[model samples]
Target: MPNPAHATGTDLLVLHALRCVGFAGLARVSEAVGLPEPDVESELIDLAVAGLVTRVPGDFGGWGLTEAGRAADAERIRDELDTAGVRTAVTRAYEDFLVLNPELLDLCTAWQMRSVDGVIAPNDHTDPGYDSRVLERFADFHRRADAVCAELSAALLRFQRYRDRLADALARARSGALDYVVDDMGSYHTVWFQLHEDLLATLGIPRH
Candidate 1:
């Protein structure tokens, strides 16, 4: 029998992507769902027409789920999990993710700030040595994280997108676009944070 989770339509994919990622523009939404910009925009319009989603217009604006959309997503995702029979697998991965989550936050903090004389100060990127040290640590953390991501993807293919996006962020960071590590809007930290939200939402778990 075909897995019901794999039967999710594009509407659910895009809608839940917005739910996980929060407010984001076209490109980010497209990147999250592994869809093209034009396709995501079309689905957003459809979702907007149904009142489950809304679009904000401005330099700092993007798409977000409405209250109704949140409720709908909760119900649908639960159905997806139970119908697909992968809840246990997802739950186990979520536990592994919890172990890695704090380390990721620490890395992001190290990238953007630093400890000096017991005071937390913003990192101004003035010291190449300090920056390189943090970057190396992030790479090491990612290697450890890859295992959890792989486990999730093995159960539900949609999760593979997270792995791909995370890798892209690291690649850009390695190529000297250091902002991709944590500063850019869709940086590795940002994407990992969103994935955290996604895993919790999908598992019906509360965020701490």
Candidate 2:
């Protein structure tokens, strides 16, 4: 009894990732899916060929899902959820995730930038004390986030990966790899974004 709603192929996952992440570079998509850059690029190409997604070339461009892709994903993912009959449970979990969303974003903002002279400034990582305080808050936040992830995984097993990824990112950040907090490819923000996408996809909700 595998979860049929979970993405079965790399191409679908790539397409759906773009659908939720909006537009993103190959590196971002690769990191989000835990796939190699080359593999993600290959899958993106196939999805593009099928007209389910498109790649935009430029400094501010990457890949995105086409209208058709969005429609197809909605229909397919909705059918999967309905078939699994976990809508009410997943919806309740989504509500709980929403409650934690703002706090998570606040933590990410604090990690990336901090208050300085009554103005927000980028944390230069020069102050060990400030960094330690942020890390402590992050640890506390993760404890709460773990509960949300647990609820989500209970509703849909595919979501368990997010809990693992977020914890790994926080651990790396705590160990002095500061980029793991928000700006890096596998940062907590990146993992959280994927979790957000997964919830919307699982519930067949639109980003807007």
Candidate 3:
């Protein structure tokens, strides 16, 4: 049977993407959902019409979910999981993700900070050897993380995008885009953080 949850869910994808990523501009939303800017804009406009999202115009403003949007997302996502009967699978994957979560946090901390001259300091990327070791650890952690992501994608196709994104971030960081490690908006840490939020939202779990 076709999963009703995955099929015809572009609107849900846009809504839930905003839910996970918080307020973001069109470019970020497009990137998050792997949709073209025009298409995402169309969806946003329609969602705005429905009073599910609103846009703020300013130097720092972006699109965000309305209160009704949040409620709708919660209800729909719960229905999606229950309809597809994938709660157990997703919950198991989430548990696996938790196992690897601390390690990734440590790796991110290692990337952003280092011991220098017997003092802890922000990583300045001046030491290629130290940076290389940290990158190597990130690569190792990604290998394990990929397995968990695979399980999620298998359970819900929407999750495949995260696996692809995390890989892209790691590949870019390894290829000398240093900011991709944790600094840029689309950095590995940022995307990982979004995924964490997504899992919690999809499972209807509170952040606390």
Query: lDDT tens digits, residues 1-208, model 1?
Result: 6443354689999999999988889998998998899999999999999999998899999999999999999999899888878899999999999999999999888888999899999999999999989889888998988889988887777788889989889989988999899878669998898889999899988866
Kindly list the per-residue Cα lDDT of model 2 for residues 12-97, writing each as its tens digit.
66776776667899987876667899999998888888888888898998988889988877777677667667788789888988
Clashing pairs in 2: none
User: What is each predicted model's overall lDDT from 0 to 1?
Assistant: 0.89, 0.80, 0.93
* Native-structure RMSD, model 2: 3.2
- Per-candidate Cα RMSD to the true structure, in Å, reads 2.4, 3.2, 2.0
Worst 10 residues of 3 by lDDT: 1-10
Winner by TM-score between candidate 2 and candidate 1: 1
lDDT of candidate model 3 versus the reference:
0.93
Writing each residue's lDDT as its tens digit, candidate 3 over 28-115 gives 9999999899999999999999999999999999999999999999999999998889999999999999999999999999888897
Q: Global lDDT for candidate 1?
A: 0.89
Q: Could you tell which candidate, 1 or 3, scores higher by lDDT?
A: 3
The TM-score between candidate 2 and the true structure equals: 0.80
Candidate 3 clashing pairs? none
